[model samples]
Target: VSFGSELSNRAPTFDMDLSDFMDGDKPISYEKAKEYFSQDPSQKWAAYVAGTVLVLMTELGVQFTDSMSILVSSSVPEGKGVSSSASVEVATMSAIAAVYGLNIAPRDLAILCQKVENHIVGAPCGVMDQMTSACGEANKLLAMVCQPAEVKELVSIPTHIRFWGLDSGIRHSVGGTDYGSVRVGTYMGRKLIKCAASDLISQSFPSTPTQSCDASEEYEKYGVDLLKSEASLQYLCNLPPHRSALPY
Candidate 1:
């Protein structure tokens, strides 16, 4: 497999031997790719996207029977919170989909590419970058609700405001230990808060007086208020400022 930038005039940046990864029509997998390409970060990413494509094909019940080469190229800088990896995955996914004549919807492609990063790449990242790289129009800023890549619209860049990315010399890798640790910690907090809220909400808010105090215990709920017209504990965004325990 060869990875190159379509925008660049130079040769492909990375050439990898994928014979071992895709041996004779055998389906690729997350574990195989992870262990095989662990030593090379670049190759790892390449393998992940290819593996993801295979996984998707299997899920769709496509009887694919041949090993194929993939090309993923991008000019975006890596490890700086840019969509570098995502751009490559989008390009590769698009190419492979085209080759297979699979008419994958753009939004579905974006979401699946996100899985390539989050699950296959072992990077706990949102799908904003994939959505941007997949759905962005020329000279237009993609506006999306990135819970899992919901594209609302695309807005043109205003002449008055220019988006710039200057190198700070500090590098970032989404799959790195620091990034993973932070994500895990944040999600841990969410879990703790959700558990606490489940106990806080009383489903029987306005119940008739119980015949006995023992029956009152049953009426005094200690869990999610599912009976409410709207549940409020699932998402942090639904919580109001005054009522929320955590600061924004």
Candidate 2:
């Protein structure tokens, strides 16, 4: 979809039914389109991208007139550990941003895409997939810390070794119950560690200790209460410039 970067202003309009949206009306807001497509098992990723584009646009301060439709056809196999979902998301976002004349850097774009999946798509996935998709080069390894997506460097793939994606033969979804359970358990561990660390600090210190952190730092470190609120979650890594209406 290299053509996405060359797309003209405003998404091309298509006549779509109003009942196919969230409010059951003609104006196709991202939320409405997402909810509509989400009702069908076949259109799950469609819903994901639908929600993603609008939120991205909002974050960038683009004036959305609604009435945008996406047509996707992917060759990436589903139910594999492959970045199929991320491919769609990144492509859709890149396309929409291009059409709207939004100049998003690849790294920042990857972060924005992750926000869409975690917040809008309701998937608790890490940033590797989006980061790799957005910033990776051909025949190079993307090295990074998944601590809220810090890119270290891209290592060159050597001629001595070739990477292969072997099928496990068992179909899996990132949104599946097992995956969700693992994520829940990870966060649970983090919470326990936080409690333990807090206790250690209290026991060790003579004075009351308070961690000095801005909202962004706190969010990246823990993904705690600040990230739980919808408003804050939408702008997880990057706090939106306009926060006058934000509760935090």
Candidate 3:
């Protein structure tokens, strides 16, 4: 819930103290944090915080000249496939940004959280969980797209309907589940589409003639065009179940 930083003589260090989970606080040096990430069996979820910090420092060029301490107090159940990890990533980034007096926009913050989950945590997740956690409005359902992540709309919830959540007591981790396989299957399907619809892709993109296009480049260009074209999107969505199953 709290993150504090102070100047340090050695490399930047990080310590996380979980109030109710772990026995007590554990301090991780910068080198140790890096080592933890590289080890065969990575540091598990604990590496997420360190990874986020490293990404902020390396990718966003946030210069932190101090060691930091993170304290988390939470009752949320983990491994429930309910985005507890995404929430933690967002909170950690927000707290770190606050301590450094950095102002991060909500959408951008969500993207950063996704980066932490995807690149740092090896979760291959989209931005929905992070975006919803970061920008959710009371009594509203947020609509967003992952490719070009943006809040499209916030539909007001109907007053007549009540939303309720039930805990099934079954725990799951995205990295440890079929989530990655599904994502891979989706991309594989897209690649198959690119192959089958090569002529269409070429015709749609006249300027970039398919004759001279590398297969990989063609796939990338087709993906970009597919996401940008409403007609193409609709066609894909309206595909017959049989045709749709072909890619998988």
Question: Against the true structure, whose lDDT is highest?
Answer: 3
Q: Deviation in angstroms for 17 in model 1?
A: 8.4
Can you write out model 2's per-residue Cα lDDT over 1-248, one digit (the tens) per residue?
11222232223322344234323323345444445555655445444566565566446655556566667656777668898778888888888888878899988888888767765565667888999999999999989977767889999988898887888789877766687667666554444444444434434453635333222233345433433332222222221223212222
In terms of lDDT, model 3 sits at 0.62
TM-score of 2: 0.68
Instruction: Write the candidate numbers in order of decreasing TM-score.
Output: 1, 2, 3
Instruction: Give the clash total for candidate 2.
Output: 2
lDDT of 3 by residue, 36-133 (tens): 55464423546566567766764576766566777654455566777778888887888999989989998998888776666556676778889988
* Model 3 CA deviation exceeding 4 Å by range: 1-35, 38-43, 200-248
For candidate 1, write residues 180-232 as lDDT tens digits.
66765665465454443433343344342212111223313533343131223
RMSD of each: 8.6, 10.3, 10.9
Among residues 3 or more apart in sequence or in different chains, the pairs in candidate 3 whose N, CA or C atoms overlap within 3 Å are 1-71
Best by TM-score: 1
Question: What TM-score should be assigned to candidate 3?
Answer: 0.66
TM per model?
Answer: 0.70, 0.68, 0.66
lDDT agreement with native, every candidate: 0.60, 0.60, 0.62
